[model samples]
Target: MAEEKLPTRAEDFAEWYNQLVVRADLADYAPVRGCMVVKPYGWALWENITSWLDGEFKKTGHVNAAFPTLIPMSFFEKEKEHVEGFAPELAVVTHGGGVELEEKLAVRPTSETIIGHMYSKWVKSWRDLPLLIVQWGSVLRWEMRTKLFLRTTEFYWHEGHTAHVSEEEAKEEMYRILDIYERFCFEEAAIPVLKGTKSETERFAGAQITTSIEAMMWDKRALQSGTSHYFGDNFAKAFEIQFLNKDNKLTFAQTTSWAISSRIIGAMIMVHGDDNGLVLPPRLAPIQAVVVPIFKNDAEKEKVMEVADRIFAELKTAGIRIKMDDRDNVSSGFKFNDWEMRGVPVRVEIGPKDVEKGSVALARRDKPGREGKTFVPQAGLDSAVSDLLADIQASLLKRATEYRDANIHNVEDFEELKQVVQDGWAFSYWCESRECETKVKEEAKATTRNIPFNQPDTEGTCVVCGKPSKRKAYFAKAY
Candidate 1:
């Protein structure tokens, strides 16, 4: 059978996303409603993401621990805002062990409530206040509409919860995590993002401040790549998580929690994928390089396979994740397309002639132009491939950064804001009022992506209400 071509992204982006996600072997619909079965390839990508971030978390003084998946109803009720925010989406467990229970249990949508409860018990004095714990697990949120990784009811993520003696310390921890997330997205995923504080209406439930890293997709819609929340003793006071200060007085500890989820995989697909398929950043690709040996006959096969094996071994020894394809049943054309769809960062083609010439043809997945491929001699081939992978990674980030910046528009009035936001990000001064924010979303289907951290704090008139504003807000149609 001929290989099937995915729907063109320009014609239908949503359909293209769905087809590419499945065709590329990333994930699929689960048997259960509103869930997905993350296949091995998809899980491997997530694993790489987690492992990289995990090191960063540790460097910042976080240690991993697991919390129970189920939370008691009383825990949710402890924080009024949190309960109100998640109540409609809670999945209740009325009967455990096949019998009725007196109090209902809720599966975790996020782990703040439970982790806060634990910290309340584990902390006693100022010495124990800076408790940093990380959990890698799955969370379930009942969703009416579900997309694979973007809005799934059940998904995997790493959530870090910490308590500090002072509000200043807690705020610093929150910002520190946000910085780490920004580095991960830029360096590892090759996805450029806007870092800023979320508007009050969009901030996390029960948080005094919420910051995020938002990345724009190919369709110009924003994807919230990661978030850091500063609770400022909101949950700590609610849960009565009191700790003795150095002055010998009891006070509630400040709290913070941050997370990045499987949804990042979706963001990567949208940001880097092309009509051909997913174009993975070299750093995150499971198989960084795939060696496909081409031979027409037994004699040619023997010689080509010998050279391919040697090259693969050299790359492997040099700490590159690679695979050699020497299947006789399938044509080379099939192998090429298959690997391309899988988004292998680099492909090394070794034919009889190339083997005889002690060289291999290298093709990069990120570049669709003629310059993507080149012939490199086998001597120091491993170093050549490494340099090529680094170039591909950097080029992907440069292209994405350029696109994101170009789509951002500076508009002075609501009318101009609405016009530019139809297909890109609009930079305008917002009054920071719920009424004005809601009006913009209701009329233009755009919300405040963030109040960027580094933008100048100049006085300007609000885009919608014409009121005095403190800073420019990033507005966009988001996922």
Candidate 2:
């Protein structure tokens, strides 16, 4: 089948993203509305993402555990703010096994309520204070509108919940997890994200403080990639998670919860992808390099395959994720486009000519066409490919960072903030009041992304109300 051209991002970014998700074979719309089926290729990508994060969590004294999928409906009621925030999205099970249940069970939109209940029962002394656990699973929420990975009804994530005896320890754990999230985005995903505190309205329900790593997509829209929240004995009190302190006094535990979800896959697509397809970062790409043997006939194929197999084996031995595409049915051009669409970082083409010349052609997915093509000797091909992959990784990060920095503007007044948020992010002084925040969202169609930790030494007037403001915040249209 002939491949259909995708709509350019400039032509229609929404359509481009929707089409690319399926065309690239990452995921497909499920039979159920607002659900998606992640294909094998996509699952492989997710595995890499999870493996890295799982290791980091373990390194920080967090252990993986499982929680029940069905939570008691009454559990949510224990925390008023959390229940109020998630009420509309809860999917309750009122019937089971052809019988009407005494009380409804909620398909967990999140495990906070259930997990909190368990913590209350498990903790009885200061020795068991720091209960650090991470759960990896899928969650369901009754979302009205959904995008494949960005805002689906059911999505995959790792939700980490921890408890400590002191507020200092709980807050420290929250910041530590956020730092891990920021590092993962920058190092493994090659996306430059801003780490900051969420405003009161945007903070997670029942959390005393919420922080996130926000990224700028290709269209200059913001994506809240990951979040870490600190609950200062809020859930503890509701769940009655009391423990005997070192001073022999009963005290509520300080708690924190954080996550980096599949929504991050959406951010990667928007941040690094082109009109052609996905541009996955090398460290996270399932297939880092693919070998395409180019030949016209059986004799030529034999010669190219001999060299191609050697290069593939060498690269794989060097700890590179490599694939050998030796299909005889499809044209080499078709194979080229296929891998490009999947965003393999490097493509090594070995034809009869290349075999004779003792060299192979290398094509970079990040830079398509002739500009990215190079011919390197096969004598030390493994080293050459490694260096090229590293270069491409760095180049992608640099290009994306420049794009994000250029589009973020410092606005002096409401008019400038409104105009800037139309196409990019507006960084301006804010009075940090709900009325001012609501006014900007109502008029400009932009919301406060975050109040960044970094700030100016001198205070300024609020962009909206002209009132004295201490710090600035990012305002932008978001996905």
The alpha-carbon root-mean-square deviation between model 1 and the true structure, to one decimal in Å, is 1.2
Candidate 2 Cα deviation (angstroms), residue 389: 1.1
lDDT tens readout by residue for model 1, 326-426: 78999988888788888899999999889778889999998753467888899999999999999999999999999999999999988888889999999
In candidate 2, what are the lDDT values of residues 294-330, reduced to their tens digit? 9998888888888888889999999999999989899
- Least accurate 10 contiguous residues by lDDT in model 2: 1-10
Scored by TM-score, the top model is: 2
Pairs in clash, predicted candidate 1: none
TM-scores for the candidates: 0.98, 0.99
lDDT for position 473 in model 2: 97
- The number of the candidate with the highest lDDT is 2
RMSD list, candidates in order:
1.2, 0.8
